[model samples]
Target: MITVLVIGIGTGSPDQLTTEAVAALNRTNLFLVPDKGADKHDLATLRRELCETLIDHDRYRFVEVPDPDRGPDAERATDAYRAAVAEWHAERARRYAATIRDQLGSDGTVGFLVLGDPALYDSTIRIAESIRDDGRLDLAIEVIPGISSLSLLAARHKITLNRIGQPVHVTTGRRLPEEYRPELGDVAVMLDGSLQCKQLLPKHGDLTIYWGAQLGLPDEVLISGRLGDVIDEIEAARNAARAQRGWVLDIYLLRP
Candidate 1:
């Protein structure tokens, strides 16, 4: 059986790696890095840097796979979106299975480094399950937790996620409803490439927003203020950074 470690490397920052995560990295015989094409090549570069800095590169092998594209369809229909994502994931599973079979030893451990906690919005855990379900390979899976971008965003802003007795709602940009619910306390939005916060500002002008992009790395950008006050600033900054870096991963918290 091959032991697959789904290790969380923690949002582009090596320092955010926990001791357990470091240990998991050191135990890997192969590291699977997904190359999301030219626009996001820096992501794979970061993974390589992590491996080079944390473990002995000579003792382990690195496998790079081109990430599946989700297509340019703007299909907001529930079934259409589900179908698109499912198809993409299926392709990823095939790639993962091929790499495991071709590169991993029969009894050695392999690793897939995730950006945040695997339980969050990451799809690695789901992909692994799909591979296991296919039953083509003998696989044992282990997950190692690491600092999440959400937690790190709050830390960088020097604020707690929730107020006194308030609750926090975590969601993605696609699922963010058109209506704002004040009762939800605070909302942390992730995987949002659409600048959803800007759209919400017109409706909830009084709300406060804490936004951060490329959190942890040296080129990180942070903006926080009343939604109405800093909406344009955040938009400009996000666009400029994305154009400069060819890609961007940003998150924001909305407080009512």
Candidate 2:
């Protein structure tokens, strides 16, 4: 049986990797890296660099797998999204099974390195679930948590996530409402491409925002101020960065 370790390496920096995560990588015999086409080559390269820099073991083998793109389809229901993702994950599980059987021949420890904490908006855990659904993965699975972009973003700006005893809401850009419930203390929004911040400014009060793009990366962009004062700047910056890199990942925190 193959033992699988779903380890988080944090955002692009090796310094962000926890000692336990590094140790898990070194202990594994096989390392799995996912390639999401050219736009994401840097992501795969960063993982590769982490292995090269941190792991001293030469016996550890690396495997690169191409990910399937789930076509553009609206998922209004949770089951709809789950079904679509399950199909995508089924294909991925087949690849993983084939790789383990053909490449490693079983009885070895394998690591699937995730960009951030596996539980937070990452599909690695779902893929692992797919593997289990098929009864193909009979391995002992373990998870090693890493620093998340939220943690990094908050730390970079030197701000706590919430006000005293206040409830903080974490949400994605896609599902965010044009108007938010004013009772939430702080909103840490992620996976946002819609510029939801702009829509919320009309309802703004003492709202201040600390937003960061490409958190923890060299080309990271950060901005903060009254939501009304900086909404346009954030939009323009996001567009420019997207055009510059051909891709962009950003997150923001809203507090009052």
Best candidate, TM-score = 1
Over 27-126, each residue of candidate 1 has an lDDT whose tens digit, in order, gives 9998888888888888898898898888855689888898888985445676888889899989998998888888864678889999988889888888
Best by lDDT: 1
* Candidate 1: pairs in clash: none
lDDT of 1 at 22: 87
| Candidate 2 local lDDT, 115-164, one digit each (tens) | 76888988887777677667876767889998988888899899989878
lDDT of 1: 0.87
Q: What is the lDDT of residue 225 in candidate 1?
A: 93
Superposed model 2: Cα runs more than 4 Å off:
73-79
What is the C-alpha local distance difference test score of each model? 0.87, 0.82
**Model 2, global lDDT:** 0.82
The 10-residue segment with the lowest total lDDT in model 1: 71-80
Q: Assess candidate 2 and give its TM-score to the true structure.
A: 0.91
